[model samples]
Target: MTKTTPQTNRRIVLASRPTGAPTADNFRLEEVAVPALEEGQLLLRGQWLSLDPYMRGRMSDAPSYAPPVEIGGVMTGGVVSRVEASRHPEFKEGDLVMAYTGWQEYAVSDGTGVNKLPAGFAHPSHALGVLGMPGYTAYAGLIDIGQPRPGETVVVAAATGAVGSLVGQIAKLRGCHVVGIAGGAQKCEAAVKELGFDACIDHRAADFPEQLKAACPRGIDVYFENVGGAVLDAVFPLLNIHARVPVCGLIAHYNGGTLATDSAAILRRTLTQRMRVQGFIIFDYYVNRPDLHAAFQQEVGNWLKQGKLHYREDVVQGLENAPEAFMGLLQGKNFGKLVVKLD
Candidate 1:
């Protein structure tokens, strides 16, 4: 009997689920055999794997927009990878592409839903950050529903994060007075001074609600909800009549706890105030996205080139750290977009 030699493939799988905040023990790293390429498929060596708050929804056993990750299964994520071998006609060895390759050092894909990255792109890892899913989410959610306008007051929480940062910048471009809410002093400073937000308040402050209220004395015309627990509480009373809210993420509640019961009252206020509030998953808007996505990418890409749109990345080296790094995301420990690098 012949034994097959295992090729290099490292994976991080769900070890166990947390009742609340996830910990290192929730993920188990294991060695697996590199997959053989099949027809129209390519073997990818992951370059960068994005760690996002949405992954927390997948970890829980409760129902959500996406299914929960089964215990002992590999955690799912978007990845930037280089083609190591290809049986597909369109891809070749060394071609860099973006895919949903999850938390692994190796993956195999049949080229469907893959974007061939532009050659000489300075940061291939960017496919998981500013130019990628998070960016698109901010673009679509804010535009299709929120419709941020000139001279309006825009308030967004998680202001230093991937989606929230772009939301602030795009709103600023519309001539809005943008106020950002972040977790700490350092992040608040960067949100205002670095990203050009009109003002930023630290949610960690002892009197955060008052500070946020002070920053938006004119009341909020648009509320981009990113961290939707206490921060929502602060922003609620400040929402102006006919305000628009585009609900994208609720990172503060990702740990499986419900917010205070009074949160339901905000919907009543929405009805009485005639506000337009909508919750959305970006992927839902992709079918009608070409026009907006192109416009957003062009403008945002230019801003990036001109040193206007700023992005911060919390990079942790190796696939091995994905579990711990993801734990940090749920706890707001990540200062910006989090990505894990693997050779």
Candidate 2:
């Protein structure tokens, strides 16, 4: 039986675009009546909402791979939601699904891109973090582009973060020495002690570059680039000949103005070292290849079941807090994968 739909739905919409770091003023909360579902539509009650660095790009009206979220529009996000009413053949009431339902408490989907949760799923929220996009980003970028080898040194920035955490773990599984770069002591410690990295360098330290160089004495074989800026500059000299770099997120420069890298130096090094710096957008993998998705789910799912993988979520309560929580993510204030719990 289907549950009765709520008369009004709470939502957070983009109030304004920010010049640099976004603030609470950039968002607006509103209440509106939930629209009646059509014959092929299903009502989704959002449960867990993901807050990622990529959302920063979506908030802006800049040119990018995906279109920016329009002003007065609901902020874009991946959500774990429950079906309240289903007029669609492939869905039913009480079904939990993963969908891009944005920052709203309720949504109507025509079943496009909605995925049913696996039976006996222990943590549905993991779908927004480790088991979902972030995990796949780490897997696809590291394995396919980075191509880490046994006994080689692999480095990743934002060490305790959603993607970097998985990148380090998978590198470790491949028998590679993993070095992680994080903002502070706590995150660095978590990366080394909990996430099992060979060494975790504190990017906040005065001698961060020196520390990173020391950690990777053999030079970096594969550099999983997440947070760019000074971190990329530091990793540049340490990159080994013919090293592979999987360019993923650039969170460090996402909020503030772009950080200028020495192009001349990069060109000289590119020629002399023959390093492969390939930029990848996770969406490409989702579209170009489907097998990679299946491989990641099966392998990472098995690892999770066997206690070979660990995940952490920094869950913020309430839909109203989404704006503030998102701001904190850009500041690196959230300890792990930032998620919002509506219920």
Candidate 3:
């Protein structure tokens, strides 16, 4: 295959920090000449870009685990790219790789953080979803932190989403009764039917809390905390003694929301119940436990092949539409793992 090199690279950069929810105005698209690659470097043409809730935190200059994106820097993201050209000894042209190439059409890399996609991999985009970071996050957080046992009840918020879907499925495989909390009738239905969750409650219902309680007759032994705010409020009272809560994300509170005011009550309940609530970032596990990643790849990869796991992607076409699609994601408009297919 003859790979064509583009002269110009189009990228989306942070125009300004957002006050509340991010808008299209917060991102600016600009085209610039692709830089010439030096020796020991490679040029990448992006095929897919991942848009996740964590990106919202990076857009702000607030204190966080990772540094915020600079005013004029390309918005940070993970990309699956094809090596259009390479002068590096380790990598070759025509190789498919996963890299932190941000929101750009083209990138130059020294291969520091690039991982070559395994040959004959059926889906390259799955490297950004189920078989990648999100899948690992679901597996490690639930199995290691949540530690669900047989016949226990597990409740997952954002049930049909990228991480939550896998969390629920993995819990079921461990012999637990899985209940999911999702928005709207359609998502709730899919959670139960498609994802094999025992029961799914629609959070938009007026009696959502009541429905969640009804679904979990044995009380929640493991609560996979994906959406905070109202969902957290509903799950808090139902946590059984010695319940485990793996806090993977707080998507509801990501867009400058008010802090929960009932901390005293929460602490009191935690004391009485002897609950275990731990927050985790996937990057930590990558650094400290390479073995877990290997296990995840083997176990989850096998489950996927055996038709025991389900994955979904809410793909948006064109780089120009990424800003609007991202804004919609914050509002719960995206139905699955959000990714952009670069033109």
User: For all the candidates, what are their Cα RMSDs to the real structure?
Assistant: 2.8, 1.2, 1.4
Looking at model 3, the pairs that clash are none
Instruction: After superposing candidate 1 on the true structure, give the runs of residues whose Cα lies further than 4 Å from its correct spot.
Output: 1-6, 261-264
Identify the superior model by TM-score, candidate 1 or candidate 3. Answer: 3
Clashes of 3: 0
- Which 10 residues in a row give candidate 1 its minimum summed lDDT? 1-10
| Model 1 agreement with the true structure over 239-318: per-residue lDDT tens digits | 99999999898887777556663846977889887998789987776666678878867777778778878888999999
Task: Encode model 3's per-residue lDDT on 136-180: one tens digit a residue.
Answer: 999999999999999999999888888999999999999999999
Q: After superposition, how far is residue 95 of candidate 1 from its true place, in Å?
A: 0.6
| lDDT on C-alpha atoms for all candidate structures | 0.86, 0.92, 0.92
Cα misplacement distance, residue 97 of candidate 1 (Å): 0.4
For every model shown, the clashing-pair count is 0, 0, 0
TM-score of each: 0.94, 0.98, 0.98
Which residue pairs come into collision in candidate 2?
A: none
Please list the residue runs of candidate 3 whose C-alpha ends up more than 4 Å from where it truly belongs after superposition.
1-4, 259-261
Off by over 4 Å in 2: 1-3, 258-260
How well does candidate 2 match the true structure in TM-score terms?
0.98
